[model samples]
Target chain A: MDHHLILRVVTRLLVAPILLFGLYVQFHGDFGPGGGFQAGVIFAVALILYGIVFGLSRLRSIFPDRWVMRLLAFGLLLYAGVGVVSLIQGGNYLDYNVLLPSAKAGQHYGIIVIELGVGITVFGVMMAIYYGFAGRPPSIEDTDW
Target chain B: MTDLAVTLLLFFALVSTAIAIALLRSLFAVVMLSGVFSLLAALLFIAMDAVDVAFTEAAVGAGISSVLMLGTIALTARHEMKPKRWSATPLIIVGIIGAFLIYGTLDMPAFGDPNAPVQTYLNPDFIARTPKEIDVPNIVTAVLASYRGFDTMGEVAVVFVAGLGVTMLIGGSGGFLRRRYRETVLSRKDGQA
Candidate 1:
């Protein structure tokens, strides 16, 4: 991996744009053909690509496992919390119509918040799975590839 | 005509890739071929005007899964182990199931038929009311996030549980419980000292 100068350089160049694209997909989902699940996977892909190219240790330093686990739970909580808030607002559970003064605005806010929750949870899960698989010592070497 | 041609070409590519994956002994090549197969399926989804589905297939099916498979190969063997003996039992079972599935599809309405049950049912309602109610440009998002919020919540829960399960299983020493146990032991040792 150290000898692959071109791969290292290209990976460095590509990581930022990949992350930006993932954000675009996450936010633009309402108007376009992407959403939380796709966006989350795309976001994880940027980090996974960096892990594969640079090294797992380098990737972990930037995104520790503890943070990954926390984010995983937090995302689910955020989604469920939205429902609870709506319930407290006198709407039924997950009833977004009462989330705000305007029904349309409530729906918009609820959808965005819930989508963000979905995205965060997905991103965490993907990264966790990657860490689970990649954390194990490889039986095969770099030369095998 | 061009759409039909592109679809047929993609279908052919998908089938060939599947065959290659089955025949190849090298696990690496098989994994790569499966990714290619997923990409072809994504292209087919696009041709069918299911862009959201296409995006998911391209990202999760082709991208993440391939990398995971490669990680698995890194942990395990590069080449598949040859079967101890050729057995027709599994093949026969698969063939029967495939025939039953094809037979089942024969009774279904033609693809994209306006009169089909799915097309005539709640789909039209969702399409009709999405702009007025949810007011999102993407009907799919509105339906998934708002109209079917509970189902999406369940899906997210499923994803969360899946991550938890995997983290508990193959996560090795990375498990939170394991780390806590280690910390407790270290504290006990310090107290003893």
Candidate 2:
């Protein structure tokens, strides 16, 4: 009980900073020590921390199944949006210079946008996996409880 | 002095960890050791100047995968299951394969050699062509999203398939059986502690 108490306390305290760092990493990937994948992991880790201490019930409220599915779709949509934006601007699919008025800035913008997509999808996938495993079918043996 | 000592201590800690993993019987210990090994491997990668691979390993291996495994562990602990011994044959087979892999690494370039075949071949082309062809300053992104797009697609498919499989197998709500593991663990705690 004490161990769980410690875990709960630590998780709540640390989750905020982990999330902030993830955002920072996502935005600052092109210039710094982190990127989409790293940010995704950090973001996922924070949630995992919450799951570890509090159980799956807490996570359900924060990230319902429907919303998580949508987040996954949203990530892919972001990536596809970039591609569509490029197509409309007269370049090949996924070509990013079409993202902005200026070609060079568009490239950077495109990378960041794509990275955000990757991060969201990854975060969603991680949560979905947690949900799939942590949530399971009932059996006769479980009736004792 | 302090920096050198810290690296050396970390290396020593890693060696002891490896030994502990080799000797331990508990599955939780094994999982924890694997996380430690992955972390050590990440540090080794960083030391070798493989920042990209290091980042990937640290993120996936240490952060996400560890969390996933811990969740799995917690769920299983709720149920009372007999401790079955793991088969040694599989372990032996894996050991032989791992030995061969280590041997293959020997034939590769020496650690951090500037003239390593990998660095010489890939980095030069990446440095040159990224600016000219892709027009993306961050060459790794260009290489990941476009140049090696097929690989990324494969990874996405792998994730999709896994989630699909899990959803298929588990199906519907996780009510009692899911909580069983936690209950058993709590009972065990009450009994033992």
Candidate 3:
């Protein structure tokens, strides 16, 4: 992988834009086709591409498994927390209408926050799965491909 | 119409890719074909005006899954081993299941039918109320995040649990727990010294 100069250069050029696009998809989801799931995969794809090109160790060093696990739980908690907040506000669980003074604003805020939660969890899971698979010692060599 | 033509082309490509995946003994080639199959399916989703689904299918199905499969191949075998026996029972079972699936679809409404049960149900109401209620340009997002927020929460939980499961199973011994264990062992050694 280190010897593949072309791949390294191309990946370096592409990673940032890929990450930025993932963010665009994440935040712009309300007005567009993409949301948390798609954006999360895209975000993971950028890091995974970097890992494939550079090395898994480098990827881990940058991200770290501890943060990955924490984010995974935090995302789900955030989603559930929003629901609890609404419930405490005398609304039904996950009822966005009661979150704020205005129903529309509540819905907007609720949707954005929940979508962010979804994005973070998805990103965590994807990276975790990648780590689970790639962390293992390769039984096959590069020439095996 | 060009839409119909494009859909047909995508379907053709998808079937060919599936067949190629089935016939290929090389696992690598099969993985690549599966990615192609996903890409074609995403294109078909786009043709059907399901851009959100298409985006998800392209990103998860084609992109991440392909890379993960490649990682799997690196850990496992590159080539699928030839089956020692050609069993007709499994083939018969698959054919029967496939037939039943096709039969089930035959009772369903045609593609994009306005009168379909799905279209006639809450869909119309959701569409009518989205602008007034959520006011999001993307109705899908509104429906998913606001209208059916509970279901989406469940889905996020599912993703979290899946990550937890994978981490427990094969996430390798290199995270916080391992570091803590090492620290404890080092402290025990220091006490002995």
Instruction: Name the candidate that leads on lDDT.
Output: 1
Give the DockQ (C-alpha) for candidate 1.
0.74
Clashing pairs in 1: none
In TM-score terms, which candidate is top?
1
Please identify model 2 stretches exceeding 4 Å from their true place. A1-3, A137-145, B1-16, B75-99, B129-138, B145-154, B171-193
For each candidate in turn, the interface RMSD (Å) is 1.3, 4.8, 1.4
Candidate 1 chain B: worst-modelled 10 consecutive residues by lDDT: B172-181
DockQ of 2: 0.30
TM-scores of the models, in the order given: 0.94, 0.77, 0.93
The top-ranked prediction according to DockQ is: 3
Which regions of candidate 3 are displaced past 4 Å?
B176-193
lDDT of 1 by residue, B32-124 (tens): 999999999999999999999999999999999999999998988888999999999988998999999999999999978999999988999
Tens digit of per-residue lDDT, candidate 1, span A81-105 = 9999999999988889999999989
> Would candidate 2 be rated incorrect, acceptable, medium or high by CAPRI criteria?
acceptable
Model 3: lDDT equals 0.90
Residue A30, model 1: lDDT of: 91
Q: Mind giving the per-residue lDDT tens digits that candidate 2 earns over B59-156?
A: 88977777666556655653334448767897899899999999999899886688998879888887787776557656777677655544554565
